[model samples]
Target: MPTFKKNQSSTPKINKDNLNMAADAFKESLVNIRNSKTLHYIQRQRKKISENRSASEKYTEFVKKGQDKPRLRDADAPKTLQERGSETVNRFVKYVKHHRKPRDERAVRHINPKHLLWVLGGICLVLIILSGVNERFRAPFRDAASIVVVPIQKGINSIGLWLSDRIEAGKTLAQLEEDNKKLKEQVENLTMTVTSLRQKELELNRLQELFQISEQYTEYDMVAAHVIAKDSNKWFSTFTIDKGTNQGILKDMNVIASGGLVGIVIDAGPNYSTVRSIIDDESYVSSQFEDTSELCMLKGSLTLMEQNLLEFTDVSADVMISLNSALITSHVSSTYLPGILIGYVVDYQLDANDLTQSGHIKPVVDFADLQEVLIITKLKETSD
Candidate 1:
């Protein structure tokens, strides 16, 4: 028979929360007999009590006095903020420690039973292969077979590393390509800008030629006007002379430069008059070479642009021209007066296809930007 140990009343312990936990533990243990390690002894004692009818009568009275209602968990359980926080912290710590996210392979494999089986089968096959190769893997057997393949697992690892590096290299290559493209575009833009500047330089040189021509003929009643606006093409080399009718300019008046005949005044408006430049294909003048004193037709065309070009052409191919030969207007010129400067003939073609030599004449005027100009008032002389 088992002896029951009674609780000692001397041990005093009470904290409301501790009491609840302890009471719950006690009730749980008592209600569940399977939880008791000493169940055999408890049963023997119960059997003894049943055998003795008087003992049974005493046990019944004792059981009645001692038995109380088991503790039940409350539906509205009260917990402190600290307890809730502690629980949350514990849960988070556990979650972090054992947080194994589903691998991509695992998710796919689980979804497909065939894939899972295939992978397992492959694993088994590899194990069998390793087992079969184990005997040959030993040194003596490997030496006998002399064709020892080291079974390069490192090769696979190297391939993985190489692939990763290549990916990084590809990104670097893309960046370089972008940089190269930007640099190329910038170079093209710079080239275009340089070309435009060169054209403007040539124009300025031509306008400067006119200025030099003016210095030679100081006796003429001439005033300079800038060519304000004009067409860039050969068909319309006309522009507005800044010095207009307000400056006593008239219609049917001949406009000239110290260089040569510029054009006739097409229309003399209030403040301005349009004059065609000699560069226009329609312009033609009689010219004489100062060195040879030979008369020839001087024509203008826009074809001569190689390196910083001009627009003047020679009508007589036989007209002797050396470097720095001065070309001036003859007295026979219909529209322009005699002794006006055209330009210096630096290069010329002695032989021609259209009875005229095509050549370069460096003009005295800077045509790109002209601040000062001389218009021959004598060309527009009024009747007294």
Candidate 2:
């Protein structure tokens, strides 16, 4: 009997840990219940019912206002849920609307797409047949189509032509630019060729003149030489030739050019020789008229040579010298060869002494520009 008594001390006591575990289990059960599909379906049903109730309320209000039936979408103004679900097979059936007019008993049938296509094809076939049989049947259709199609076709053609013209213009411009470049190159080449030809022509003319001079003095053995240097002045009054004692050129040797007597060598080296021209102030030559043996003294004057003239003094007053009289070296000259032309008498005047005359003479040689000259190898002494 004592053992059977309840053990009060062994009874389990409640604690915070146990209470917290019980609370967590209760909250997890609540979350699971809330997330269940059945609960979500119930919520959706409640929302749909509310929406339907509001739509019905709106419809009732509209009816109470005594207005004609208001237009409403099926989703916005649905009928009773039971009625909508009961007619599942009805959704697949074609709907026939009954007209409220005089033909209320007849149902208005909608047009089927397949039937409409068939009808259009039949009509087109009939038109094609009739157009082939008669011109009148096709005329109206063709004219009507052209009224729209012709303008469109013409517009397209105009655009095509404009684009083609632009392309052609661009091509033409490129072609012209190329041609212009070629033309410029051709012009440059032509200019160079003409310049070279001009130089050659000048050389040819100079050689011709030298040839003629050589013919004029065929009696003397002459050596051709080029002028190598000259004084700084414009005239070749004193110039060096590329000939000296090595070439049988000696001091006092006579020099001649294209016209006549040029000068006499004043200094001679082994390779070069200097000549003082007739225009030199210190130059003097015994001379006489070509036709007459009357002697005259030809003198150089720098001042008168400016006018391409020299001085002729010591001429006897009785001499028959006139303008343009030919003057030549006299045989009595110690240095110059005999009968060599010097110049022409351009002017003369009786000297103050009344025994002699003086005048200006234009020399045959151009001392201002001398390029080539001839040296008679035979000296005046040897010639004598």
Candidate 3:
């Protein structure tokens, strides 16, 4: 609501009394207008004159306030409120046209903030690239990584190399150890074989020495002969030697044992010879007592004695003989030495040609164990 402000310059109570008087006068004038037509005409003409004067006064007031003059002919345009508001709206539009609004609050075009940001970033990147061409401006991220991550990478690389080297070394060590084990086993086996070979060499040396001592009898012309064959049925009675008539060995040659006479060479060939032991039939050797001068003859009698024994026949039956008396060759032996050692007489006999009792005579020479021998070469020729 618009409050009407009093115009202080106006007369207060007098103006009010004058207004009442004018109103009363206007009422009288209206009554007169109602009473007579000529009076009414006269009153209307005065009222018209008063309205023209009021119009003139209002037009003068608009002119004094710098407002457009109200034309009575155009009064119908200000009838509606929209029409009445047009003059004020037109005046405001004209003021805006002459004086522009502040530029800060004004719209320019349709804006895309994201696209603007991209354009601005592109410009900054171009500037940065141009600056990087100087070879001085580096990426900040690269500098930071060099400060924090380079040492770690180097450590990882070193650890990988170390582990790889260790693995290779371990494999090499294992292979070497295995090779060493094999070499050790080979060396041990070789050492054992060497020891066994040395022992065999010692045994062969002993056999050679024995062979040398057995060869000392050069007078009899003893020859080295290997035992080639053995008679299985007459194991202790016969055996074959590799030496024969071709080697100066003959039939009935004396075959001496390691200590004394053992048998006689009987069968002879070009390259082989057979020996009949004293324990066999048809074998004989003249023997004498070692302690006395009594003479005897060795005879083979398998029926009278057991295996590996012989007999001294035709002795005096009452004569005594020792159990281990040494017996040897007598001077009466024409084919053998007169005093070459034969063996000990274990049992014997003495006789007066037919009354002598005979028993077994264990020979000192073990005929079955003879490996080598000496053949006597000096003997009487066969008498014609």
Candidate achieving the largest lDDT: 2
Find the 10 residues in a row with the least total lDDT in model 1: 145-154
Q: Global lDDT of each model? A: 0.60, 0.74, 0.67
TM-score of each predicted structure versus truth: 0.37, 0.42, 0.39
Root-mean-square deviation of each candidate, in angstroms?
34.6, 43.1, 56.9
lDDT of 3 by residue, 1-384 (tens): 223334589655434444445545655656645557566566556665555444335445545665665676476557778876897799899898656734433565445788889999998897689656753343443356444654464456457667867887777777989989999999999999999999997887798797875532335556766555567764246877667666888777787777677777766665567788777776778878878757888887656335567778766666677778877877677666667677666665444466775556667677656666677765544454
Query: Which should have the higher TM-score, number 1 or number 3?
Result: 3
Displacement of the residue 175 alpha carbon in candidate 1, Å? 46
| Tens digits of per-residue lDDT for model 1, 1-384 | 223333477665443444445534544555568745456555445455455344435545556765764444365333898877887798899887555543432465457788778999998897679757763333343333222322232344356557867887777777989989999999999999999999997886698796764543446676666554455564566766555656887554665554544556654554555676555566676777778877766665655422324544555766556778877777666656677777777676754475776566765544444333456666623344
lDDT (0-100) at residue 292 of candidate 1? 83
lDDT of 3 at 267: 61
Candidate 2 clash pair list: none
Candidate 3 — what's its lDDT? 0.67
Ranking by TM-score: 2, 3, 1
Top candidate on TM-score is: 2
